[model samples]
Target: MTADPTTGISSFDPQRALALAADTFQNEAEALLAIRAGLDASFADVVRLMLSCRGRVVVMGMGKSGHVGRKIAATLASTGTPAMFVHPGEASHGDLGMVTLQDVVMAISNSGESDELNVIVPVLKRLNVPLVAMTGRAGSTLARHADHVLLCAVEREACPLNLAPTTSTTAQMAMGDALAVALLDARGFHEQDFARSHPGGALGRKLLMHVRDLMRSGDDLPRVAPDARFLQMLHEMSAKGLGFTAVVDAEDRVQGIFTDGDLRRLIERGTDLRAFHAGDVMHRQPRCVRDDVLAVEAAAVMEQHRVTSVLVVDAQGRLVGAINSNDLMRAKVI
Candidate 1:
């Protein structure tokens, strides 16, 4: 147990350090399991009340719990439920007016005795708002006044000092996630609904944005008749800046595609470019997609085949549009 004089600290033992880490993880896992088990009839009641709320759910807490409350409110809002976070301290300074009688109040306090939160309890009750409490102590004032209680009780703090909120906060966060998922499932929230809530996110782009929105249509689409010469197709590809040109038959059906890759191969093989038509040099039955498909899905197809561009066709296999990696990049679907 002697300290190392050179380092001026106790000698570190790797085995002991690893053991402590394992114990901490085990304790947190057990605490979260306890919180999960606690989700019973009371949890159902909370969901029922929240679903029935006509106004937004006002989530209020203080200190570390407030940070967790903000995340919970965001999760609730993004998933079918309308919610917003209100600081308990701010609520006392006339911010309490934000909570309406039709709204539901979700209060978070590990001790359930946070003085700032206690100040607004009576006002919330006077407003006749439903109070849902998330805390460790059921007998605590906040829990006593709550219409429903979510028990986030834990065995002990993960902090070595036992003063910091660690395991308890983790339990609370997991419980909040469970609540959001339950509500989302109950409301039958779909990907399209989620896209509406998160239009700026990747999933939103995948679900809401179509290939037509990102494809180069009309004159911008690099296309030429099958009878066009190789040089003509190359010129079209260069002018459109798509690195490829669609070779179409008289019926406007996509007959083939000639890209910069084909040009390189032709040059390597010393083919007479002047005498070859687009039909001779182009790749027949090139990868094609529908304009109605998601731009994200188009990107996936391009990446899967290691190609830079794809031809967009209609149900009749007629060339209607074109897209490249640049198009996906511009649309932020990449």
Candidate 2:
């Protein structure tokens, strides 16, 4: 073990650090559970007020609570609720203009006595905006002016010094998450709605991606007539580079599929490739999906059936497109 020059001892102890971390985690977990049990009808009141507000939810806080408030606002905004964070100190210095009578204000302070926040309470009150307080003390100055109060008081702090904002901040963060999620559920926000807010994210790619967006259509789709010779199916599969070709009927309806694996198995058996037709060697009842189906669903279908590719069929069960595992990989859905 390396010695610490500063402490004149071992640089670090893994067991000691892990044990302490576990203690901190347990303390924070207990704090969140306590807050959960303390939640009452007032939590619903906060949601109802936010829902009715015509303007955005303006979250205000000081110190560590401010960091949590910013995340809370982001979560709310992304989950269908329009929200933004305004530092309490900035609000006093003209950022208060961001808060309108149409908006709702949520002030957060562990002790609920932040001077910067108290300075603007009257202005918010005079503007006739609805006020909500997330604080540990119910009777704090900020809470008294608030139309609704969410108790975020923790029994103890996780900090060894018992003075740091560890457990209290954790409780505040958990409460904010709970409130935002409740609002999300009440609004019936679906994954698609969430995807729109996060269009550049992986979730958006998974939820909003459709088979039509990634499928190989027209000439890109490998297709051959059912009566085509087995050698001709191989030519189509090789030309399209999809490892498979759909055997279609006269009206473009899919009859079956011929893949590279089928050719390998046929060659292994010394089958007469020259005489065999595509219909005779193709796998009947190939898995097919609609163009509008989610790409994630297509991936699920592939995984479930252990196939590398699937045919995309139209409304009348006619083959219109094809997609392989490579397409999903490019789209980052798989």
Candidate 3:
């Protein structure tokens, strides 16, 4: 029973706090499991309704449900389902114009009777938009007016008083995720599609960025003719600072590659470095990728071959560019 030095308030019991947190986890996990078990065809019905909707899925809620609704809308939109969150209060004040006959309305309420949300139900119906309700109460006003109902009921909240939106909100969040997963699968959404929607995100950079988007080309690419002196190849490699140089023929077709590692191996074998030509010292059949290959694919090539740099070539097998691990790291694609 220690008193706080700052506020002179009694310090909380750590064991009691931990116990409460554990109970919250258990309660939320159980709620999600229950919802998973109780899911019926209504879930599919909602997915089908939204899939058929030509306009966006307009999500609405109040308080904590509103917060959950916003996240649901974001997940849906990023996962190939066009969606937006509309505040119920704002909807009554001309924002309702956003809802059209082609849109689908998803109203979220734990009790399924949020007055603000319920107020706009009639207007949504009048607009002839499909209404999908996510609620804990199947018989409540919001559910009753909905074209399809997604039951998010829970036995009790993790709050000691069973009043706070704890386990209930968890259930709602899980249900929303489930909906997003199902909808994405139904739409045949791919990683490229998700990347298109989130170009600034890490996954987008990895999936959408191609070798041509980041590779060094032209004068920036370190290259030398097969007959060039070893010193000239070293100078090109040093000038480019890519730790490697490609050995090409007069037609700019890649014949081999000389890297710092090859230099070290040659020196270790006591090879005559001064008398060597680019073709003589370079390693034949160097690992390379097409300019159009995904940067992540290039990373994979580097990983599989245990190399830090990869040569980029065109359809005619001509040297077009060079990409290294550093380039991928700079682009955050590795």
Candidate 4:
């Protein structure tokens, strides 16, 4: 008996659809848990092999596994492992030339019998390239030929028909992530290395940038002698446009700071500004950070103290530069 697909077009069941979606999640989660529990020393062996590789890790897959393989390659590359994804179909047509004796190959296939992948296994072996197979069939030909095997077997697909690559592909991705993480830990890869690889984004800015990199230094730094008149300090602050100016001593050490906010406060109190000097009007012990401090940490100091700007000082407390919320925003470090 054939049930016409058109027959159910007018009887959509929202509850049934929701229930099926939840079932898919539960099924995939269980598969991941199973794989996690089944992990063994083979996982460590593969990590060691990859960690000691003299060249890149070439990843290969077909169909849905190919998509997952690309993501895995990207994660590995960003996390300090040199890796690239090659299509298995292309490998038979000379892309296999990209694989070298010095490199390692990781092939992903849920069935452990991808014709495109299996066809090239012999070529890889002939070239003396180490083959790591990520597959579900431990006894299958791909596994038997592999130097190492990452078993990703799932009881069944998340598809109600049990024919789609649903839970199986999820398991492959998780296994890839596990390998990449372990390899990174073995190599001692850290956040700064990640930031260096991802230099175009906000994460890179926050991790790789320091206050000295973004601060206004040399003549751009606004500083005035402590004996300078209040009007002279205001002119210095206005010219530099950092919302404040540092009051320094004869030795160029930071004595205090004066800001536009202080000016406003003085005006509101009707204080005569003509009689004031930088030393008299400046707020002593103003917020300051070292030039070597991370820009994100400087942003924290500003936020914690409710200030818009901070002085950048050297080891001797001499004003070397200045940074503010605007500087951090411009650099995308906050």
For this target, which candidate reaches the highest TM-score against the unseen true structure?
4
> How well is each residue in 1-334 modelled by candidate 1, as lDDT tens digits?
3689998899888887888799889989988887776678999989988888999989998999999999999999999999999999988988888988889999999999999988888888888899999999999999998888898988789887788898888888888898899899999999999999999998898789998888889999899998897778888988998888999988889999998888998899987899988888889989999988989889999999999889999889899999889888877888
Candidate 4: tens digits of C-alpha lDDT, residues 1-334: 3345878545667887899999999999999999999999999999999999999999999999999999999999999999999999988998888888899999999989999999999998888899999999999889999999999999999999999899999999999999889988989999889899999888898988999999999999899998898889989999988888999998888899999999999999999999989999999999999998889999999999999899999888888999989989988887
- Can you give the lDDT of residue 282 in candidate 4? 93
Alpha-carbon runs more than 4 Å astray in model 2: 1-19, 200-203
Give the Cα lDDT of each candidate. 0.90, 0.92, 0.92, 0.92
Worst ten in a row by lDDT for model 2: 153-162
TM-score of each: 0.86, 0.88, 0.92, 0.93
Better of 2 and 4 by lDDT: 4
In terms of TM-score, how similar is model 2 to the real structure?
0.88
lDDT of 3 by residue, 1-334 (tens): 6899999999989898899999999989988888899989989988888888898999999999999999999999999999999999998999998887788999999999899999988887887788999999999999899999999999999999999999999998999999999999999999999999999899999889999999999899999998899899999989999899999998999999999998999889998888989988889999999998899999999999999999999999999999989999999996
Error of 4 at 180 (Å): 1.4
Off by over 4 Å in 1: 1-16, 249-253, 264-271, 279-282, 303-306, 314-320, 329-334
Worst 10 residues of 4 by lDDT: 1-10
Kindly indicate the candidate among 1 and 4 with the higher lDDT.
4
Per-residue lDDT, model 4, residue 214, is 93
